[model samples]
Every structure is written in structure tokens, then in C-alpha cells.
Target: MNSLENFSKWLQEEGRSSGTIKTYLQIESFQKWWVAEKIADRFEPEEVTVLDLQDYKQFLVQHARNKRGGRLAAATVNKLLQVIRTYFKFLIETGVISYNPALKIKNQKIQKSHNTVRWLEDKEKIRLLRKINNPEGMKNTWHYKRNKAMVYTFLMGGLRVSELAGLIIPDLGLAKRRLTVHNGKGGKERDIPINDDLFQALSEWMEIRKESPDEIVFLSQKKGKFTLQGIEHVISKLGEQLGLEDFTPHVLRHTFCHDLIIKGYALQVVAELAGHEDLNTTRIYTMPGERETKKAVNSLSMGDSF
Candidate 1:
């Protein structure tokens, strides 16, 4: 009944994020298995059984190590499961699936034992910038300058890698202390303010940003468009070299949002600047640390020691 296409259409109509829609449609891995199992021939959604889903889950755990050289993480598996469950739920509501087979599937519990901030601290950020500016431990070359600018923009601007990659010179508002982010997550446009630090970095970069046929703000060594993967690779290598192993562009984004909250900025203001779809997402960054909570509780006055 072409349910997949119909489901995709529904997602688009519901204003789902482009990333979510894309992931749902990229179900080729599941489809390949279905085809080999002979279930791809005019498969009826209502005809599926719980046992069928169980078998597929097992197959994922057993044979899907080809990608990561190990079984997929529970979080990854759960994401795929959520998409299938939602698809079937949609089918049932639309009179496609008379019964839902994925109803019993449970989401995996994510381990949060680390309980550490996902973003960089102010001092670590300074170290990060220092490393990017002179990776060779000497002489800031042209590439080092560009690397510093790119990293600073992600940290201060809080842009998604894709958004950064798509940026052009025309989106800048250097004179006004902000930049217009075009085609961000969920196809939303946002204006993000840049502080004096970020402004100085960009000023240096613009001198060598180099006028060319490509209007993209960032460029690669090959004279082609900058790519998400390329930017990630640069950040990853810089982080490792600077002794901050898990650093990433998104970490910089998280740090940007976190710093705003710590600096006494209103939650709504941070939400708007970060372009979060929900205020609840912004609230997550404000969660008190264990140490902070302990200190608060201990501040109470006890009149007499028992």
C-alpha cells in the first residue's frame, strides 16, 4: 500500500525535523533484510506479528556489527525502533494496520553514570582555541587562522554543522553584532549575536576569507565547499591534540547555551539564541550539578548539634 511514502508525507505535513524525516526514509538496511526474508513482496502492515519484530531485533543484534565492528548501541537501536513503531502507529490510525505489532517494543535505558557536562568549560575553550590557532606549536599559518575562526564560530554562534557549512558571506551582520543563520534545523532561520571575542576571530578570518566564485564563508583546502565531515575531522583532531578527547562542534554549541544560563541570561533569551524548538530543551542545560546541589543543602543553619 506504499505506506512508507505515505508515512513520510505525514511527517512532512506535521512539521517534523528534516533530519528525522531523512532518517525514517533511510530504512534501506531494514528493507534489505525484509527482501531477503521474502517479506518485501506487497507486505501488509496489519499482517505483521510481534514474533516478526522480535526476529528482526535479534538479527540487528547478531548480524549488524558490519558497521561499527560491534553490535549497535542501545540508543542507536532504540532510535530505529521508535521510527518503526511510530510508522506502524500511523498506519493503524490511517486504516492501514488493523493491529500494531510494535506496540510492545520497549525503549532501552540510557546510562547516565558519567553525569558530566557535555560542553566545554571556559578554560578548556580557551585551550581549544589556542590549539586550533597554532596546531604546529609555532607560527600561525593561513590554515591555522581559518581553523581558529571556524572553531570559534561554532562555539559562539551555536550553529549546527550543516548550518555552518551552508553559511555564505551575505548572511553576516558584523556591523550589527549578529549573523543570520539560514536553513537551520527544522528549516528555521535565526539571528545569533557574536561577542567581541568572536568578532575579532571573524575579522582576522575575513581578511583571508578570500573572494572567490564560491560565496561560502568557509572553504576547504581543495577549493571546494566545506563539508560537515571535514569540519568534524578538524575539530576532532584539534581536541585530541589539545588533550580534550571528546570535544566536538556540538559540544561548543552546548557550551554556548550553558554559559548564557550561567551568566544570568534569561532562559527564554538562551532558547531563542540557541534556536531550540522547545523551552524544555533549554532547561535541560540549567540542571544543577551534584556539587552545586550539595553545597546548597549544606548552607542551612542548624541551631544545635544533635
Candidate 2:
């Protein structure tokens, strides 16, 4: 067996996820290609050269074919390079390789365009909320109340879909009007504040929750916990019925941040409220719309408009 096979075995022994192991194996394939085509033999711990590394990178860009039979994209090639770099670092740390040849290869920088944040405008938000609350035909439907509570939690509390789904009776602090979210991303916990609107919605939903106290807060009609896909289907169906575009849970999150920013909340406060670990991650949610940009520019004094 080659070093790649040994590394795969080691990764499995270390309890790495299948996805991670698969990505590492893809990197190992690139290394095998380097040995077969560029170096004329397997790279020993300390015998690989920077020139050989550069040749492998060129092969990734000019010759590598994706599963779709297309040339590898710059982004995909960059990801492969990152995987290779990480593997070499791991090999060095484990004393399997004395020198990290992959480190000598520079990654191709891919420029990112400003992504358009999807959010509901204020009027659209109000309209959607009212529509969900007062569903004309469905007077006593479970979907009506459930969707209303879901939208309320997202807009008012800024809870992610996962956090909302994972909620339990113990997570709610009725007196304080707060929710304790456990095991958020990165295994972090946070208490998010709730307003009267959200409190009322939760109270209404609680009247209908027939499960035990330890059961999940949100449940489907089948009395099972609502999955991410289920929530997505609800949002999409509602969006279509209401003639709205691109309505998803993430769009609701964007609306939460956009509403907060427009109401003059500081970026740091918004970041904390959104449960983001980094302020930079939250900054993406604060992109101003046309009206906001106009207001900002109009407020600036340009010294007699030179």
C-alpha cells in the first residue's frame, strides 16, 4: 500500500468524518498525479522540490477535469490546493514528512463580487406577516400558526432555523422574555431576547404543543420534530402562494439584520444578536439598500459640492 492508503487508514482510526476523509483522499490523488507525471517517482519526506509542486498546480488548472467533464474551476482548484496544504501540514506534524512540499505552491486568488443579500422590504415584511397571521381560507390550520410562529421567531428573535428547531420548553424564559439557545454553531450558547410580538406567538403555539416538556418546541403534523427541509418547504410554498420571490429562512435572517441596521443599531450589537462569532461575518448582513445609501450620501457634507 502507498502513503495515501496509510493516511486514509490513519484518518479513519482518528474518527474523522467520511466527508473529510473523502476530501483528503482527493488531495492524495493530486499528490499521486504529481509523483506519476511531474516527479517521476513518489515524493519522499524531504526530496520533493518547489518546481515539482508548481507543476502539480499547473496541472490542476490546465488539465484537471471535474466529474461533469469540464475543466476545474479556479475556485475548485483553490479548494484542492487548500486541502493539499492542510494534508502536508498534518503529515509534518505527525513526522510522516519532514518538509511540506505543498506549502511552496501559492494558491490562486479568486475575487468575490459583492453578494446581494436577500431580504424583505419593510412594507413587504409587514404585508407577509399580516398575510400569514390572517390566512383568509385557512382559519384554523396548523400551518398558519406554525408558519406565523416561525416567521415571528426569525424576525423578532433572529434565531437561526437550527436553533429554532432545537428549542424546548426549558429553553424559554417567559418572565424574562428570552430564549436560551444551546449547542449553537461551534458548540456555543447564547440567550436571545424576545419582544412582545414573539412572546405572544410562542404563547399561542404553546397552547397547541401536546408533546412532553422535553420534546422539541417545533413539531410537524406527525408530532415529529421539524427538519430543515420541512421548514424550507413551508417557506417556499408560502412564498409562492403570496407571490413573493426568494423567500427562505436565510432571507428572514437577512431581514432581521437589515431591519436592525436600519433602526440604527451598531454593527457589533447586530453581530452579537445574530450569534455570529466574528463581526466580519455579520457585516455581510448589513448591506444597505438604495434608500439607505441615498440617505447616507445625502447626510454627508461635500464642502460646497466641488
TM-score top scorer: 1
Model 1: per-residue Cα lDDT over 1-306, one tens digit each: 376788889888867767778887755456566666764675555666887777777776666674659877766777777777877777787887688989987766655432455777667878876666555664546677678888889888888788888889888788997889877766678999888878988878777767557788888877578879998998888788788857888888888888889899998999889888879668877876455567788877485665
lDDT of every predicted structure (CA atoms): 0.77, 0.77
Off by over 4 Å in 2: 1-115, 212-214, 290-306
lDDT of 2 by residue, 202-302 (tens): 88777767544537878876778888889888888888877888888888888888788888899999988888877866776567665567778988979
Provide the lowest-lDDT 10-residue window in model 1.
108-117
Clashes of 2: 0
The true-versus-predicted C-alpha distance at residue 225 of model 1, in Å, is 1.0
Candidate 2 Cα lDDT to native = 0.77
Query: Which pairs in model 1 have colliding backbones?
Result: none
Model 2, position 273: C-alpha lDDT score: 83
Estimate the TM-score of every prediction.
0.70, 0.68
- What is the TM-score of candidate 1? 0.70
